[model samples]
Target: MTAKFIVIEGLEGAGKSTAIALCQQFLTSQQIEFINVREPGGTPLAESLRDIVKAEHQESVASETELLLMYAARSQLVHNIIRPALAKGKWVLGDRHDLSSQAYQGGGRGIDRTTLQTLSAMVLKGLQPDLTIYLDIDPVIGLARAKGRGTLDRIEQEAVSFFERTRARYLELAESDERIKTVNANQDIAAVHRDITQVLEYFFQGLN
Candidate 1:
């Protein structure tokens, strides 16, 4: 059987990590084989790239630079981690993927879509998630959760307007993509987990 690629995506502090982890746990209980990977930080090279991109010190980084580095990390991660895991017939769960680049760079930074499309082609090599779960949340609540996490990264330091643009772009993409599913993430953690699980169950019903 071909491996199922699932991508969990959302703004920072939207409980994406928690939801992904819960999904993994549920899959394990079902005796499913799976590999969890996070984009821009999966393999060794990609993890290094993640540090550079998320560090608070690089506040002056240009939009183009950020986009390029993200693709670089993605290129490495795909070749090193995701492809092999999938080839082995193990499910792949990604914490975040290309949609994040589209949101953060194209929407937040207002980059040219043509350039992003070209970069994605060169780096992603046609690999796409079978199912993309978007954890939707308000920017204010999301930023509040981020603030509670203590320190903020360069991207996290952006104004509310940036996040608004990011969230809007994410919704736009979700609405256009049949494989994408949006889940409300403003509720408590358990409720968010329940919604995610319900979505996943319905999605996987066909596979089962």
Candidate 2:
């Protein structure tokens, strides 16, 4: 059987990493072969791209630059990690993917959708996630969670209003796409984990 690609997406501090971890645990217990990875940093070169993009500075990285950098890293990730894992019939779990660009660059940075689509098509080589789990949380709450951490990246340093737009866009994407599932992130940690697992299980069960 061919492996499935599952991408977990959300605004900053929406507990995407934790939920991804939980999802992986579920797959492991069920004896499902899987490969877990994240975008913009999966490959060594891509990880370098991540540092260049995330480093705090006031050099004014344009929205297009952000989009391109993400695609550049994504291009490398697909070739080095995603394609091989899928070819081996290992389900691939992605922490974040193209939708983040749609939300962050298109929504937060006010970039045009047409350009994003064009760039994505060019770099992604038509690869798309089979299932995208969008963890939805209010921007205010998400920002607060992000701030609780020790440091902030260039993108994270954006104003709260930027994140507000980003979160709204993420929800918009979820509503418009059948493959995208929205999971409320405002609940207690365990509850959030359970809800995410239920959604994943439902999807995986459908595959079988």
- Where is the poorest 10-residue window by lDDT in model 1? 54-63
What are the lDDT figures for the candidates, one per model? 0.90, 0.89
TM-score for predicted model 2 compared with the true structure: 0.96
What is candidate 1's TM-score against the reference?
A: 0.96
Model 2 clash count equals 0
Please give, for residues 1-208, the per-residue lDDT of candidate 2 as tens digits: 5788999999888998898888889888988899888977899999999998898756877777888889899999998999899988999999999999899888999999899999888877889999999999988888789989878788888898998898888888899999999999998998898899889889878888
Give stretches of model 1 more than 4 Å off.
none
- Distance from true location, Cα of 106 in model 2, Å: 0.8
Query: What are the TM-scores, per candidate, against the unseen true structure?
Result: 0.96, 0.96
Best prediction by lDDT: 1
Question: How many clashes in each candidate?
Answer: 0, 0
